[model samples]
Target: MIQKGSTLPEADFSQLKNGEMTNPKTNDLFGGKRVLLFAVPGAFTPTCSHAHLPGYVALADKIKAKGIDSIVCLAVNDAFVMDAWGKAHNADAIEMIGDGSAEFTKAIGLDMDTSVFGGIRSLRYAMIVNDCRVEMLNIEDPGRFEVSDAETMLKAL
Candidate 1:
């Protein structure tokens, strides 16, 4: 798990742009701004689709209002899956990001293999990072959920 007040690991990935995709790194995206980033195991899985992503989507506007420059949603899935999932969920408020290869998630020390999935993946987590530094982190407890929600993150901010 990532610790509070630590620097967030950098990630470079593509985002949907004009129906295509844009290549950008973590520094480029949140360079001098506040960022709220969340990660899920996959793009369209049950917990992610029904709960995690929606929570961030529903709070994107509010998160921005609280001075967040961008609300980024990341997954290990490819750009197509991430983009498609975002479109399907009406995730216009936040930026849909594709980690594709899980490089960023592992760098941040949030990688785990949920025995159920039988493969490496990013744990369900969320964090508020400023200038690439972590100001707050809300990593879920294994398979149990206690934090890592918009409401909790908003409160921290």
Candidate 2:
């Protein structure tokens, strides 16, 4: 898995912006910026939709107040689903990032195979990245959601 002080790997991601699909490279999102990034196993899952993404959406303003240039929510779903999920939650302040093929998740060593459940998906986690380097990492245990929540990350900041 990725660790503190390690720079993010090069990868491509997609997001829905202005009703259009935008392809963004890693540098475009993380370079020269302090970003609060959190990942969910999949979009619209029980915990993710009810808690994880909502927490970040609620706390986004406060998180950005602490010098974070942007707040991002990542999932293994396609950009269309991600965009719809964001809209469902009214997450206008958060960037809904889609890693459709688990490319970025695998590169960071956070991908997990859930077999019949969902195939390949990212583990739930949150991190603080500054200029492409990880400043802090909070990864959750399997079937658990503790350290990676928005409140914990807010307190840490």
Best prediction by lDDT: 2
lDDT of 2 by residue, 27-140 (tens): 999999999999999988999999998998899999889899999999998999999999999999999999999999999999999889989999999999999999999999
Give residue 103's error in model 2 in angstroms.
0.7
The reply for model 1, stretches above 4 Å from the true place, is 115-118
- TM-score to native of every candidate shown: 0.91, 0.98
Query: Candidate 1 lDDT, tens digit per residue, 1-157?
Result: 4687887667778787778778788788777888998888888888888888888888888888999999989888777888899989999888888887778888888888766773778888888888888887888887755688778887777
Cα lDDT, model 2, residue 54: 91
Which pairs clash in the backbone of model 2?
none
Report model 2's TM-score to 2 decimal places. Answer: 0.98
Model 2 residue 148 distance off true place after TM-score fit, in angstroms: 0.9
